[model samples]
Target: MEARLIPIALTIAGSDSGGGAGIQADLKAFSALGVYGASVITALTAQNTRAVTMVEPASCAMIAAQMQAVFDDLEIRAVKLGMLGDAQAIATVAAGLRGRDVPVVLDPVMVAKSGDRLLPTDALTALRTELLPLATVLTPNLPEAADLLDTAPACDEDRILEQGQALCELGAQAVLMKGGHGRGPECVDLLIRANGVTRLSAPRRATQNTHGTGCTLSAAIAAGLAQGMDLTQAVTRAHAYLQGAIAHADGLGVGSGHGPVHHFHGIWPNG
Candidate 1:
């Protein structure tokens, strides 16, 4: 009997030296979900739970070359995009993924864990114009959605649905506006499509290990899609997986702000 090979998912994002977000978190999520993870680092950040002190972006050509090398050898079933730090990097990644008809989960990571800006103000237009249209699903938090739409909607369920719809008009096939930042007992994630809005509500875990929550969620969804799950099912499973990770966060003392969730909670005891 021959052993089946796990499908691969490519994460084109930045490197978080803290291991809390970006490529590190993405790869961890993919591994936890039983997928082989590959990455093309777009930028490197000197960051931790405290704040991002510095960021060094890779050249656009180098970034594109990395993507080419991976796609040439690996059968990447899905792609999760995180922080493309600049307009050039965004355009480069967008061009590279243009012809690849794989499920692409776009986590518009505009802000860092410490509330510092990751995606530059100038890059927002490039991301919206060049990348969002190519995404299979666009996952943005409330602030990100508001930035994309140029208006702040109330954190209510109805407003979230409306915001999701508005985001869809920006060229995404589907929009998942995360409500974790919203003030509520339930972490409501609104999914808007041509069919209508579907609200996925999970009980909010009272934990500070949320640094990589967005990155992990997007990666998990990409893994699910790589394994052939539909959009709704993928999002559902991703949410559950993230909830578990949040509940079992590693008590790694570092800074005063939020820390990293334990991505390998179920797979590895001490991870």
Candidate 2:
């Protein structure tokens, strides 16, 4: 009898030297979800929990070549996109993904965990015009949603649904507006599509190790999609997985700010 083969996922994002977010986190999530992961680094960042001290965007041609190299050699079923850094990078990625009929989970990563700008303000228009339409799903936190739509709505369930609708109008197939930053005891992530809206709520874990939550969640979802799960199931499983990662966070005191979640928590034995 032959053994089963897992699907493959590609993450086109930045490199985090801290190994908490960006491509590092995405690969962790993919591995945890039983998917083979490949990467096309858009930029390299000198970052830690506290802040991003430096960032270098890979040239548009180089970025595209890396992506081509992956697709040329592997059977990539899904793609997760993060920190594109600039309009050129965004356009380069969008063009590379245009004809590929793969599920794409776009984590509109505009700001870092330390509140530093990752995507340039001038690139937002290009993102909306070129990338959103091609995205299978767009996962944006409160601030990113507001920036994309140009309005900050109250963080209530009703307003979130409205904002999700507005984002859908911008041409995304589905919009997941995260409520982790919303003021509440429960972290509610809302998924809105032409079919309807579903709100997923989980009690907010009291931990500082949330550095890569958004990126991890999006990558997890992409992994699920690659494994043939439906949208709602993918979201549910990803959320549960992230909650567990947060609960088992490693108390790595690397910085005074947020730390990385324990990506290998349940899978590893403590020494």
Candidate achieving the largest TM-score:
2
- Give me the runs in candidate 1 sitting further than 4 Å from their true place: 1-3, 250-256
Listed in order, each prediction's TM-score against the native is: 0.96, 0.96
lDDT score for candidate 2 against the true structure: 0.90
lDDT of the structure predicted as candidate 1? 0.90
Query: Local error of candidate 1 at 232, Å?
Result: 0.9
lDDT of 2 by residue, 195-254 (tens): 988888899877777999999999999999999999999988998898888877754544
- Per-candidate Cα lDDT values, in order, are 0.90, 0.90
Report the poorest 10 consecutive residues by lDDT, candidate 2: 248-257
Cα error of candidate 2 at position 76, Å = 0.6
TM-score of 2: 0.96
Cα displacement (angstroms), candidate 1, residue 149, comes to 0.9
